[model samples]
Target chain A: MSTQTVGTAYRPSLGKRVQGWLAGRFAMIVAVLVLLYLFLPVFYTFIFSFNDYRKSNIEWRGFTLKHWANPCGAAGACDSLVTSLEIGLLSTLVATMLGTLVAFALVRHRFRGRGASNILVFVPMATPEIVLGASLLTIFVNGFTQLNGWFGTDLKLGFWTITIAHIMFCISFVVVSVKARLQSLDPRLEEAAQDLYAGPAETFWKITFPLVLPGIVGAALLAFSLSFDDFIITSFVSGNETTFPKFVYVSYLRGIPAQANVIGFSMFVIALALVIIGQIVGNARKK
Target chain B: MSALAHMGGGGAPATAMPPKEPSGRSWLPYLLLLPGVLWLLVFFIYPLAQLFAVSLYSDYPDYPGYYYQDVNWHNYVRALTDFLPHFGRSMLYAGLATFFAFVLAYPLAYAMAFKAGKWRGIMMILVIAPFFTSFILRTIAWRQILADEGPVAWVLEHLHLLSFMPNGRITETWVAVVAGLTYNFLPFMVLPIYASLERADPRVIEAGGDLYANGFTTFRTVTLPMSMPGVIAGTLLTFIPAAGDYVNAELLGSDTGTKMVGNVIESQFFKVLGGYPIAAALSFSLMALILAMVFLYVRRYGTEELL
Candidate 1:
């Protein structure tokens, strides 16, 4: 149809032009739907969080600041937020450091059984979170026998435990993220630094280390998000301790408070904003 | 230089190559390696070993070493019971999920990679934007969206497709779990496919077209074969864990039959009738299985990025 009278038709035949216009318009409609699917829930969560709904979710029941403003508010969103923050930061630090070094080892060294080492490092990546959580719990129980009695329960599950669990899985993400960057690094830079009589430490610090820092930073951020978002592993290892995800889990079943929506939406916005900022920074860096 | 000088030159190779800068640390790499190795071993390998040990014998609080000495290999034998079925179910869900994800992802990835026209960054961001929210909450929302009284149902009812609105709701159904898996993993599928497709060096396709081949033949012969590596990687990434996950089962599936090896392993570690050893045994077995396949694959393909 478009070829029927192309040169003579100015902008193709009328039918062809109409079809083209409709296709473009249809594409925009689909794009809008995809964007909506991507954005709606967190937006919904954010909007609903401001609602006064307690015993019901049928309507908004008017906006209220009670959920976010209240420090304790019967369910203690504040404490869990603090707890989640503490764990995320700690886990991020540990996973980033360890993962970076692992990437370093794979990239720099001509190690024995490197392939075997890689498999072992990534095996944790394949295993499900529940399995990991369960295994960690087993380790805590069977190994840490000396310090069991806490708050009348013969088990201890809280900050330290959750952090450790987060790190175990998170380190692998860091390793993969950093390793991808490391593989692209030029060995010539290090060789040049060494030829200039720089010490090995100095060479790595000036050349190799700086080159991989962005990846490390990205991995660190990824680890933070992963740890913050984790629910299953935390639940199994947490014993009696509760993180925000867990709190949301329990709270959802009992009655999803407007605070839950508020917190969820706020998280969504921050995450989206962070991603956008990262993209802008990434683009600027590229330029 | 010193290393070469030590090749029995009878005396430091005449010119003495800068006195060899005190080979202070052949130990540095190992030192760097120590902390991570220790963390993994103590927390990961050891616990896994312990779990295997426990699986061999039942746990009793009365037992001295935290497990019974019964030595029942039957746990391995019995993992075939409901366990094997869940494994099958998990794989089925993962398979369906990955299939759907690939189907959903391919055209989008294609458009983004080859046809999106300046909106690629936005498209890429859209692919990963789901990670911004908690997966569980998303699963819950999925439940709502797919529920009988929800949006899908409402739409279906309005469309007058059924006698009385057959509720597109499949919340606790196998389909739902797979839907969640597909939703979560669609990005995984897209990035790799788009990457491979994007890297296709369009000249090859143009050359094929110039050779009198049509679009389909060009895609099949040139594009598909070239993108196989990414296809394999993406499929493996989606399929391997999809086969192991229990989150979909726990959140979306109806019966225990939907539970996968992941759920069973998790249960061994935590659920009421939990068995640590069984969990370990199962995990080790699965790990060994994955390691074997991945090991063979790496041998064949020469990269460990399959995950």
Candidate 2:
């Protein structure tokens, strides 16, 4: 190191120094530009939230805060937001529960058909959303018709169908996320608990559950976001129900409302806050 | 929960186990797996099977929503013959988008992994923050950005680059759709490549320099090969979704000419009467094609564990 420093101190040429500096800053420059590219749309969305547009939101009008203050000024926007929220929460809860159990089964317990289970979990993720949505619609239509024929009952496609489809797609993502966390856990922690005379239930409730909670929470958040942001799948199964993305899609043909941008920015803010809080809490726990 | 106890203690020595085996509770694994497996079976597997069967059905001549199971298999032939151009367009657009995403994402991911130092966390947050917003909203934002009088077009016109474009604009063209896809799926490419690059040892890279290789040579031989897994994963993720996506095309591309297979499947499913068999067949074929491509790709570049 001393020899190298001495050599560099004696023979530092302008070309070499510039080359070294360029080499050092090259990746950083590219990263910042890439980040700007990524956030350009986000910046647009946030900026346009305040655009005072009458009908067509495609052009930049003068700015105002009315849209932000009255986000639900547009009809069906708030209702669709609520519908998306309901589906997100419900699907997240169900997918997280079922996926966590399946993840635990796959990671901790030896079982038959594990291969099949793994393949089943991965297929939904690998398949395209359009395919999944179309197939589910076919099944729902056929199944509901058969049921209506037999029991003289009318089961229509709406909220429940959308929720079911959301849960179905969300489960694979949940399992993948939670199973990663489960597999990464050190088995020695459970062994340590057992060595301390903690029974299985006690050990699980006290030790395993706490360790796995973060993964489950993360999975739930992922599932919720996925459910909320879905357009293609929900479009097929949601008969007349307008979720947030569905609302946005319809509004796109016309002009999207500034109120929609307000909602979009609001969601971005809430998600950022949650992520920051998660990071802070994580750091505090580490300390 | 004795089965839990037994499994928990199974890691210990034989003498540490209880003499009585929990034989009666051996079904716990299956019990734990029941709900998820059943859900997948009913919602995913069953629906796919139904879709395949529906694909074989023939629509009644005069009935709108009525169909008979024909097993004629002509649906596939007709779908392929009619929508073959769309299939090619989807692949072309997705491939171009994936390639461009890689070009943009590689340096960003590299900087995040190795050069960000104290700002890595901030960079990661920035990468994920855009994704948290509604996807449709972001695509809509792209419409504004790529509009005829938008900033992009203004800059292009000022720079004399507009003449090179087909119609002196970006929107309502394949360019806009490809750009939208690349922008939307950029993070998917970046994250995996970042992960693999982050896992690569700095010492191994430095060794290339020690062995008299220059920086570019070292990067090409060492860094590129080391990051291939991530590149493969990223490309697959971006390409798969881009190929299947209709949102970008619907929002940005020309309504009539630039339609992809996804748009066709979507329109058939929702708009046209007696469009179920054709849509189902198209979807089935798309899935089969994707699966085949992925299988070949993984065989060529991916590790067994990835599969």
Candidate 3:
């Protein structure tokens, strides 16, 4: 140790010192630049929300807050927003429920077909979104016609179809998130509960469920965000129904409205707020 | 639940799994797994089968939206012959995007993992913040930023770099499409690398330094290898989505020149008369190509940590 200390005690030359300094700060500099690149579009969206343009919101004309105040002024923007929220909420609920159960099973039980279950969760994630969308569209386009033929029922591709697709993809992510949490939990905690004479249902409800609630909440948030922000799959399955992203895209050819920007940026802010609050609560609970 | 309790206290070796429960409630695992598994089986697995069947159906003569059941091998032949350029462009663009995203993400992820310290949590949130906004909106913003009248073009024109761009334009070019792919998928590359790096043992790295190794040598030998699993996972995630994306090309690239396979599939499915079989065939081809590439990649550089 003394020899090593003495060896490094020799002062570095100017070039070596300069090289060392550059090496140390290099990651920090690159990180800041990358962060700027990541936020470029977000900054544009926020700035455009206040644009006072006559026709298109593409070019910056003058700055005003009217669009933010009247975000629903444009025709179908709010309707599409409502549709997205409904789909996001409904899909999040169903995916979370189904995914949590699967997570518990995979983490706790040694069952037949366990290997197959893991692969089933993995394949959807590995397949490209375009493929998923195309396949679902094919199934619905053909299946709906058959149903309409046989049962005198009019089955169509719209809200339900979009929601079903959302749930399909969201389940994999929910499983991953919840499974990570379940795996990290100490089995000893459950053993302690059993030693205290708690019933099986009582142990689950009073101990395990409370401990895992945060993970479930996080998974639900992720599922909702994914469902809301999706475009490619929804564009295919949402036959006549328009979601927020679809509305933004369809309007782009004719120039997007500033109100669309307003709603989009507002969602960003709301989501950020929710995440920050969650982090603070989590930290407080930990301490 | 009793099964869980007994397994922990059975005094069996830790490596051994618990014996199967004899209770009537042994069906719980299947019950718990049934709903989500059935959903995936119905929507994901069944839809792919339906798409394969659709890909084989031939179009009815002189009918725009009508098809007849037939074993049509011609659809695959036509897909490969007609859209070969699109398939090539998709691979090239997605490959370039994945490479560039890795170059751009690595340093940021490294800093967040080792440096940043107290600022790590905030940086993590910032990394995910862009996802809260609509991706289409973000891609359109890139279009505006790269437009002829935008700041980028104006600055480039003043700096004599405008001559490098074809027709003195950036917006409707391959560069714009590739840039959009890299930007949209950058976070997917970052988070995984950051995660693996964060989980790496710092003591192992410190040992390299203590052995009188130079910093670069230490990093190459120890740190980079530690993060390989994340790199593989990140590349796969970025590559798959970027290859399948069409919005960037549609919004930012030229309609005639820069279209990828995704654009061809989208248009064929929606626009062309009697285009269903060809589109389905094209989609199947893309999936097969991606799966093959992934298999080759994992065979070469896979880690057991990957799902």
Best by lDDT: 3
Model 2: DockQ score: 0.45
Q: What is the C-alpha DockQ of each candidate?
A: 0.26, 0.45, 0.48
Instruction: Report the C-alpha lDDT of model 1 over A1-287, residue by residue, as the tens digit.
Output: 67766664665445445544533454355444554665555555566667777585535579778877863564777678788889999999998898788767655565455566676677787666666777788778655575544334455677899999999888877777777666656667878999999998898788888887877887887788889988878987897788888887777667666665656666766877777798899789989
Overall local distance difference test of candidate 1: 0.67
Better of 1 and 2 by DockQ: 2
The window of 10 residues in a row where model 1 chain A has the poorest summed lDDT is A18-27
Each candidate's root-mean-square deviation in Å?
8.6, 5.9, 5.2
Question: Candidate 2, clashing residue pairs?
Answer: none
lDDT for position B187 in model 2: 82
lDDT tens per residue, model 2, B137-223:
999889889899899989999999987875768999999999999998888788778867777787887786455335666678888
Question: Across residues B1-307, which tens digit of lDDT does each residue of candidate 1 receive?
Answer: 0011011111111211122223664455566666776787777778677666666886666653356656787767766553777666765777798888776666665566556777887787766666666666666666667666666667766787533422344666666688878876666676667666666776876676546335556567876676665665566667766766666677767654467777777776666354666666676666666557655765676433443
Best by DockQ: 3
Q: How high is the CA lDDT of each candidate model?
A: 0.67, 0.84, 0.86
lDDT, model 3, position A21: 61
Evaluated at residue A121, the lDDT of candidate 1 is 77
